[model samples]
Target: MPLDAESDAIGTLLLERGALSAEQLVAAEDLAEGWNVSLVQVLLARRWITLQDLYEQIAIYHDLPLVDLEADPADDTLVRRYDPAVMNRFSTLPLHESDGTITVATSRPGPRTLLHIRDLYGPRSRIVVATHLQISAALQKAFRDRHSHDAVFALAEQDPDMSAQQVVTPPQILVLYVLLSVLLAGVAFAPVPTLIALNIFLTVFYTGNFLFKGLLVWIGGAAQETSSRAIAAGAALLREEDLPVYTVLVPMFREPEVLPILAQALRNLNYPLAKLDIKIVLEEGDHDTIEAAERLDLEGVFEIVRVPPSHPQTKPKACNFALRYAQGDFLVIYDAEDKPEPDQLRKVVAAFQQSSPDTACIQCRLNYYNARENWLTRMFTLDYSLWFDLMLPGLERMGVPIPLGGTSNHFRIDVLRDLNAWDPFNVTEDADLGIRLTQKGYRVGVIDSTTYEEANVSIPNWIRQRSRWIKGYMQTFLVHSRRPVHLWRSVGAAGVFGFVFFIGGTILSGLLNPVFWAIFGLWMIFGAAAIEPFFPLPVLYLSLVNLLAGNGLLIYLTMVAPFRRRWTDLAPWGVTVVGYWVLMTVAAYKALWQLISNPFYWEKTQHGLSKHTASELAEAKAGGPEALAAAPMPETGP
Candidate 1:
């Protein structure tokens, strides 16, 4: 092959330059053909040669001069003239202009890139070779401000109605004022009637909420049984070469200790390592974790994405920033302590294949690895088991918009980007995105793959975490409920009902639980006459049903939640779920207050608190990904 020919052979060039062994060249050739990618891509993916060496040989082959982008950076003045997206996509940056001719630096230097450069920067444009990382770094340095601003305000600017930027819009505030004014007027004029009416409404709401939850569990349990089998079988038969490039985003802040565990888990994934575009998204200020990631010396597939310091430094904002550079057909978010099933990506791909074209996201189940660590962990596990393993699937079956868990949500990058990605203002951006996807004529699918996380064992930490979740739910409800007619039309009557009970009920129940408990306490201690004025005969009957049957149903649901997982020991602990509700009530009040005070604040959940953390880390480091996957559950006994 001629050095200057259009059909320059990269492998042959690498071999001639003594960059690759003969055996390695043959293997890379096979993978390159099977993966339907270029020989350069295969060589880079396999890490057969250092990037500099491979690019140098390519520079030699293409007869192009190689430039060090870092030593002599691109001119911001010239680079800003072209679209950053196009530049990033082509890995081409305008270096400088000389005599009306522009010099460009590109990681990909070829006829196609040559044409693109000439078309964009004019026919006088010239090309030079550089590494992919160098071009990416230059782009980031040049466009950080623009990308950061877009990440934070894209949804708010483009679709105000879908954003939680304004916690309560004018119409919503007016509705609240009208409702409060009506309640106050009724109380002043007709105290007895007002109290009775309020009692009836709340009693009915409680009854409906529990009943709705029961229906979901029943439906979800059935769906889980059938669908999980089909997904697993599909995943088993999937060929490694057919898998699409997947982007895994692990966003961390001040959590360096858990990086190793996360790294091992990603390596354990069954997907081809070369095709995985894993980005460890870290805040620019979080030098500790950033340094830790760098020291780990992860494989070439893993890249550290340094997010610029910005306000509302929440996970979603970090994720939004990282989403800009994602090079994958599909993207999934994992937390610092998450250990998803190795086949999760394959299962997600298979599920997408089996789903309708409108399916834009796949939500995998989330449970805790430290389920038996403490009372809180046990209850949290049962809660997740019900929410993920049961309720989400039921929501899918019934066509109700599902509330996505914080992690393990796999999205089609195109659809996600087109939707302006995540809302930075929503603390629970995942849940908000799920609802938004449904409203925008897209469907969210549920899969059986599970991502085990470190359950909160401490009470205060659990409350902070739960409070953030509830607050985000509050924000989601407010944002989506702004145009009630539009919501009803978009998601239909069933979706409307589900949203109200699922999101609204979650908020109201936590706030109202304490009041109901106090009311019941007074009725028992001070006699029925003490509460008789508030609870008329019919209203009293309804309140009694809500207090007895509603509570019982919730407890029963919690007990049965773990049965599907064959976590029978957790069933007995479910009886103490009332205690869990008390904690939720505390968190709910905190969430409510914060919604009024600090709606966008994200209460960071501290991981590495589990008693088994040290052991898990050691296992991950020593045994590798497979060992971590095959690790047995901790002893459930007291």
Candidate 2:
């Protein structure tokens, strides 16, 4: 057969053997061209043919020996002839060496790879056909030691300066403590002036923060209108064979109650089953979840990766370890209780195809499934709706850096690896990664897809979750601010402004909220004349406007959140969002204490605590795409 016919021979054989229908072959061919992947890969990804079927066809076509790495392992001495990186790059393994000829097993033994092999082992080299999985397994075993180390945490371990958990530098802490001491001394000796100065500074700060937040909300609303129009135009469709492999990493702690439900939700995704790579990352110490997962007897595509116990056991660290074993071209992260839309993966695939290459990540919206469970859940749902639906889209529209939501973030595997994956020490690894990507000249976009999660209904659980988030935000702010000039150069002036206001302002607002609330309360209740002198006309006006309009705008934003979801029944509760902020203040103080005392400690948030989990899971399983289609837009009430 001609060289061109040789490449097409496998497809022809598959068709002849009745393994693939004529229509499937034609569709796969078209997809192979579009995706720039081989016909076998397309067929395997679509599950049109089994690995054994493809291997048999390839062996017949190539006239080479077939090897199964699992049954007949490669000789370690032969494998050691080439570096692991080179082996991975070529997708080939050295099987054996004898009589000055080295035998190599490869899935794609094309002329180019053959010639490369000949160049490495001279003209006497022999080639063999092997399944991709076999070659991958062989290579993995050969490089087991090298692959054991987590690339995600390697940078931080090598350079302590890069660790995000070290929120404040020693020098910074010293200066801050010294300044606080001086301020307290001044308060003791010169109370009036100190109080007046503090009030003036805080008033201006609050006013600026209020205006900045208001601007984001306004821009977000406008962006939502434009996005709706774009969505109305319809999205691009992806053929079954053109859909690439997608790896999903779900890090779980001791919450085994939701494992079965989580498995069902993932299986419900509207994608090719053969192309899904879902890894359930569990801590080594959490044998209960591991046992639960084992009991489920998950499908071949679903795997449970037990992470070895280490210092500062964190979700990101678990993700980092699992990432090393991922084989997909694209990947995403999901939380334990998350029930993403069935078409979310398809949406992300289409979004990536439509976006520029520089768009490294796409963040999907997150809302609570148990929004109506209780008052806390309602508020939690509103907060998510506002942040994901409005603020993130606006930031994407304006080309500003977005702090990624913890879940539903789709990423290109190559880009993610190039950026060193996630910061294991950053509690909000997703958020830190978003900034790091931007800093490296990559952009993050917002998608229309949504994932439903169980909101923490109990106040204590909510506080634990919220405080970790606040602490993470604090860490993100401090890490990025370490080199202001470099950050500005990377993201430009507008990006810098957005980061400071969005990230820095968020942390500062949480920390300073109680102080301002106290002053307002004292002014209202005491009618203190001494306080009047401290608040001059301008300061007094700004403070009053911030207290009234700023808060009113916040409440209005909360109300708007429910409108997107068409949950009008919850809109009336937006007024009660102020009480929610009070709760946030409590969490913020707790976060502050943790930040100072135990910055690296991860306070685990208990999931599966919502009363509506059973109902939501049932709805999710029954509803599928139809339910998601009828679902209202997400609304965050923060």
Candidate 3:
């Protein structure tokens, strides 16, 4: 509980090893701005320590307990010979006991911890060590290996893993109950009048979701223009060339098919090749991907970091592993399916270069390139169009922290690393990082650059991925709300409102929008519902207006997306966007259920690299006759 008791275990060991004086240790502690990063980071920044020296210190520091073991006369000589490797092989830590079971801490603990413990301890030794940092991890791995498997199963609820489940409704119990009460309360005014009030409520809500989206776009100004402006500002804010060298780490798992496409896309970034520190992070077990990279020998700009075999099984862990070696001015992440534009790096640089010191991240546009591939893709594309092109800009215009999507997000390298990079435990690390940055007095803004990606059209595939996204959003909401008063004070009322609009509103709308749609469908079928719908004639008329405005936006998106790509002929698919809403309603429900059942599960999306309509993509890429002339597929019946 006390900081110092556990704080400088290594620092004291260094003093004992003659690697650093107590005075030097104190100085290093004083310089470590939040008392988090290792002393080596401070010493390295000051050119006082070398990388080799740092690792050597850690190795010796770990050997301190062994030294202590040797000094104790009462200790058995066998204890002095106790192998650290035995514990490492078992993935155990040696935590001091306070209660039922103690934790064990060891560096580089492999996955098969139980087998090693059984081998060394002869299934008798109960004492174990775990990673010094993660106590929970060690306890589970060790206890599960040697102790009661049934007990672990009984404790499942304590840390039950959840994957995003099938989509369902949002948290509308309270809101709906209140609305229903109001409906009943208004019944005294007569059925027609009560119907009027109910109609007013639904109409206002339906209109609100639409307006909230439009408001984001209006406030942010044109997304494209804002992006272009950000190019200059971001670069200037980053101090342009004066910006520190930065690394961009992209972690891949089971993605050899999309790897080359991703590589080609990142290669197009405007950042100087020499200055661009791009690390293609890969899992240790993924030999096929490692082989593929080696075979490609994909230029010096791309470096592959095979994660240490012993790592938290998460994307963030892969990133953190690569981050240990990253050397750059800033860092950003892009998923495998992303196709960022050639000018995106410049845009991000401009935003940082020109923005205030408080700014920590700049989230660029993310839209699907193959949006017209299927009905699902079209619906997904529209959702993103409304989110990035519309909602994000509004948040930026309001000067709030926008919850960043998973990829094409840029951040100040030092600032990001200082915040512990990403949480390996958090599945939606990007969203969590956004909230954390905002909590820490940092700003998140929208940049103009657009990163195109593949949309999940397969029903199951889309469900899995969408569920994860919603679940992550739920985590973000919970994580931030855990400190509501603190969050409000830091981000202010407007920022908090923006947060609600983006996070709470998204989930709520997912449910509410469907109800509203259901009512409309009923009215369409019955010519008037059996239950007298509470709606004013004016509001009813406005609903039609809302419907038209909503439908019209489809045309806007198809036309708008082609502003640069100039696929004017394909703009006709905008009409299909109307039918696409039904798909979204279904997806939103699945996403909601997933939020409840599997909040942290990342339903993997399988990509179809085989859908490489090279001629079409080339045409889309050029935005010219060669590209445009290739033509889009004729409208298909789904």
Candidate 4:
């Protein structure tokens, strides 16, 4: 009954029961010591034996009864009294209480857990064994409604100013009404003057937008190189025992086919598997993905969190629900089709260590693996290279609030929870959270790591995805700009200006491009004489400069974006970016319409459409999980 003897006996029992090979047990014991974890954890992480078999042996070793929760469910009222999060952390549930004594069920029924159960329930408590998954299911079933409500409205209740629950506030509507009235009055009284004034304002804005973006690229490019090298070096020196427990939330809905891809990618990470708290957050109604995930037989580090159905079914909502049960110092979000570089998490941890104490979030770069699939994929890759690889770092350097990309952003779990997690009503919850963090005096940093994803190869799919993004930007702008003075005081003057030129510019350019294109087309068809009255010589010259210079800068920036990765082949494709802009214009209009009609609808982008998907899956299956984990990290640069 001694501690060391019990530990040794557990291994002996597994070997005697034929649960694991002697060779495997020896390796697992060695790893448990090096990892500073339990031998059971090492064996579970390595998937050397089934959870049922492992628990059966443990029950035999401890001389305790192993009860199947599915056959005899826990008392709902008893389980409901305790916090689900606490229950999950301890993996214990109150099964029965009588005569001042409590009967507790747990998948992990060791001395420490027994002590915890006694502390939570009473001095005289009986222990019964159940799988961790069984206890988790009981807790979820007991607290589904409460957790669901909190996930959807926690930000709205806790921090109304940051939530998008109110799509357009009263003050915002008033400002729009006043601006429209003024424009109508001017046009009625002095058409030509009003027209000239409008032209001047838009031309100046166009010039400022162009200059600001060019500046961002210049600063961001330099920052990426320097910061990346430092983070990579620091990560290389990190020891396994020194690494903290990390929680990864992969929220997917009905994407069954790509589940294996994400599972393999997570396994391929360089971090210790035993230290990972992985949750595959799925909607309760998504039976296909749920069944598919179950069939995969993922390691003990992985768990499936079924989110109860709710209105405004978005990724943020699911993640918010999952956040409650997350048991880690740090947390990150990845999509179903993502394949992050193996050392990305290590680089993020290093970045956080090197950052200021106030740094609450770290964003990584995103690119597409199938960049050469087609013209659209190539353009999409360039866009991401500029935004994540270049623009985001520039924002970090200049103290501007960043709008986070959809995936691969890591956060401090405490800060994230203190901020009420993500707003379920905002389609672009990640971006909105970034700004909110800055307003609350927390810094957001960007690193050089990349998570390659499946780019939208089909034009319609691309439109659906882009429109939702644009609409989310619209919502973010509206929510933040409701009280301009409050925003300015909170984020400061420079942050306010950056917000305007970055977030505001994205929304306006999309809505305004077609009108300007029409004007240019008219002039091309019928000489300047046809449009002379609309443009005075001074205004006309400025308009010409805005058109030519702005477009040229965009094309040039796109061309140079891919050069950081030595993707010289993509440089030529950047010249065709004008067509890409036109598609954006279309998406922008669709986004505008949706903002008016259906604001919170998340347009799901169909994944696994790339020609490369089949080949990637084949390669993953052929190489096996062990092979993928042992493979060398991908080189990030020339």
Candidate 5:
């Protein structure tokens, strides 16, 4: 194959590299001839088979002795007891076994004699339990080695890159539904006279939402009086230097489109590059991402940690895998689509600097970056503006264990490790962890920081993404509420109220949005047939006033937030906030249904596919990775 003379060099290299022996390599080459591709390609094409594997008895065929790995004598703790009985639980993946020497298969060995096993066997071991994920990873590797996209590797792990804004309770949908439902139900019981009376429902719903928000804010403020005053006065309730180095773990799967954009945005973060630990985590089989990451000169700080293949393909497992190598003092997870305010790190630093040692976490705000993208983006932005700017603060004020948003949550590294990092089995591991933190008597503070991310603009993509979120909320609710009264004692009354309004309110809104939408449509179509939906001075004025007030709040918050971050451009979406909520209603409904049906499935959002002009692409190509940062969507507000 190597013109006879060079064949020995190739074999020697493989053997020296411990990839394979000369005879075994020759036999592999012969077996690989059936692949119609290169030897490595063939090795990849063959699923569940390790590169080091002597498949089809290549060793025996070459008259070589079986490799007995156990005899190597690397006695750590577990290896000290590497008899064979412990491995009996999992597959006895024969590494190499003899009377004196018995090699085993777990790659991940730990100090403990038994738990947290990394796979000892190579990636392509011959004797593997044929899990579907293993099959998928193998297929992906083979595809990458052959016919992958020009941007496939780069875009494979593309994400919107940020978390959603803080959450709100008794959403517009729930109030609207209660309003129309009460009035309409009353009207149904009566005659034409009751039709006009149905209007009371709308008033009640509006008043209820406002009243609920006001009351909760009041209660939270009262409870957090001391802390609020301290924060407001900028007194020594915290210190900045005390905060540890923070690592934000971002996991991506098949989101190659905006990979460059996300990396660039992160590079532009306020945190010092040396102090910041960013893990651009990828699934072990995601070679496209790994390859795409190769050319970019990440100066050691931003390392690519490949998630060893695991399934139900989870966010937590990726974090868990990357956590092992994290040298940070604290940890956070950011979505790929997030564009956090530049000074966000500064705020967190300040907050953590002054807080008590047990204050191990600081939750921040998540706001949409593209609130003005369309009608949908606008409503979505408004919803978020109210949540992060209003609800989460209120919740924090009340001292509740917030059902943590999926991203932008900071954690002390030691605290996280004490809790074993993220639970790989928990889908909404963030929420679960938050609850656990409270239960453990660790305090979580709030940082007035906003991580801007793209709202789901497309309907299908929006539904997929939103559904996973809703399902995760459901998971969080279930896991934490399992011990309800115990939780109440841990978080207190104000916290309980906050959880009901914020977390429970989310599930409620998703369930009730369609009902209200249906009623509003019916009133316009039938009940108010003689009356115009958008007419009459008083009605129009009231509607205008409501819309104006909502939009005004959004504009004010965005401007204030960005001003604090020194990025005034993001504040402009406030004007169009009214229009954005319409889109969220649609997403809410889809999320509700999917939560009941397919909870764990990730709704993949496609990025970079948005049409960029030839010149834009040219500019992008010219700047290489840096110029390609972030989507060109308007950051200006409503």
Candidate 6:
């Protein structure tokens, strides 16, 4: 039969077998033609039939035998005839050899693959049917002996700077120490001149940082104003067959309580089941989470990837290991507690299609589900709203490097691998990867979608989470700044400035807030007479202005952040921004200490602690998948 005839025959067979209805088959055919993809791919993507079933039907149609690689291992000598890479690329494996003739198992035994097989194995080579899973497993087994080591773990040995290990260079340490020593000496000896100079520098720095952030907030608001315009004009429903395979990696540790909820949330995604490759990555020794996952007995769409116990033991490391097994054109990471909007994947696909090829990443906005859990949750929500809702979009608009949020970051699989995936040793791999992507000349964009997560409601948990983040930021700054000229050339002036302010300012603000507060308190209580010599008129005025205006502007940004999300009631609680800064200061100090001591320690934040889980779950169930797709896209201000 002709190629087109065979393709049409397969569709006919599937319909005859009751695998697909007439309407679904027509829709699949239309999508296949529109997207320029194969009819088999469209059918598989739509989940009309399982891979096994599809291959089974194909075998019957062609009068071939069905072979299961798992049940029947391939002959070693026959497999050795072909290179593993060739076999993997073509999705074929040699099944057996008899009387100088070879039989091969292939999920896709198309003309091109068959030609290659015949070229290598001679005209006598015959074809057999096998599921994709079997072919993948056979390839893994074939390469297992030669490629047993995980790529992510080996990255540290290959490029120490790129890995999380040895992040802070010796020169950076020396530079920091010398600066601190000089500052202390000046404060002790030449207090008058030192205080005046220091105050002047800080005043300018604070003003720049404040104005930059305020501008972003303004731009973000404007972007939001026009967001609806774009949505209504360009938004269209995505066809199921047209959607590509999307891989979701959910990395979990000891948190077992949220497994059921996480599973349910993922299952509710609107994408076709067959096109969704969801991997729940867990540490090998995390028996609690492992057991919880097993108890859920998630459907075939979900797979459990147990990462071997290794150094760094970070979430990115786990993701990197799992990256090798992902079978998708695009991928996204979700935290265990994350409840992403259902249509987020479709939105990302649209964003990717609309964007340039250099745009390798799309970051979705994140908010807390239990925003009103407590004072800490409220503050966390406010901070998150300001960062994701306003700051990130502003950064994207300016083409500055973005620091990716830990979850809901979608990436092109090929680009992600070419960039060597994530830094296993870096505590903040996501942020580090984001910078690296920009430095490599790839663009990261922000989409209008959102993913809801549980906020760290407990003070202790908040500190642990915040400190780890701060430490990671510090690590990213040090790693990227090692070669200043290269970074400048790579990211350009705007990128360089954005990195300094976004990464450096975030770290310094937390560390410097307490010091300024202490100085202000002492001056207010004991009068300025004792320190009169240190504060000349200009320095005094600048310090007072920064103390009053800089902090107030930040508080105001937080206040307006909630209004974007229609959380008007919580907007009033932004007054607690001062207290939030105090808590951040504590975390900052802890982060500094950890950076000097145990830099790579991942302080796990306990989740599923909120008492509102039941309500959140009920809401999710009530809203269903369509609710998330139908929800308005948040205005990303210009």
User: What TM-score fits each model?
Assistant: 0.94, 0.81, 0.61, 0.96, 0.58, 0.84
Error of 3 at 503 (Å): 2.4
How big is the positional error of residue 210 in model 1, measured in Å on the Cα after superposition? 0.8
For candidate 4, list the clashing residue pairs, or say none. Answer: none
Best by TM-score, which number? 4
Candidate 2 accuracy as TM-score: 0.81
Model 5 C-alpha lDDT per residue in residues 157-231, reported as the tens digit of each score = 321111111121234346658978877776677644454343344434443444456655445434444654455
lDDT per residue for candidate 6 within 5-106, as digits (tens), equals: 666888889899888789988887776666556677666555456667678788887778888777889976668667765676677888888898888888
Q: How much is the lDDT of residue 613 in candidate 1?
A: 86
Q: How accurate is candidate 3 locally (lDDT)?
A: 0.59
lDDT of each: 0.88, 0.79, 0.59, 0.88, 0.54, 0.80
Weakest 10 consecutive residues of candidate 3 by summed lDDT: 65-74
Model 6 alpha-carbon miss at residue 397, Å: 2.2
The TM-score obtained by model 6 is 0.84
- In TM-score terms, candidate 3 sits at 0.61
Model 2 error, position 265 (Å): 3.3
**Per-prediction RMSD in angstroms?**
3.0, 5.0, 13.5, 2.2, 14.2, 4.7
Give lDDT tens digits, candidate 4, residues 389-461.
Answer: 8898889889999999999999999999899999999999999999999989999999888898888899999
Model 5 misplaced regions, further than 4 Å: 1-210, 216-243, 423-428, 516-585, 609-620, 625-638
Model 4 segments more than 4 A misplaced: 1-6, 619-638
RMSD (CA, Å), candidate 4 to true, equals 2.2
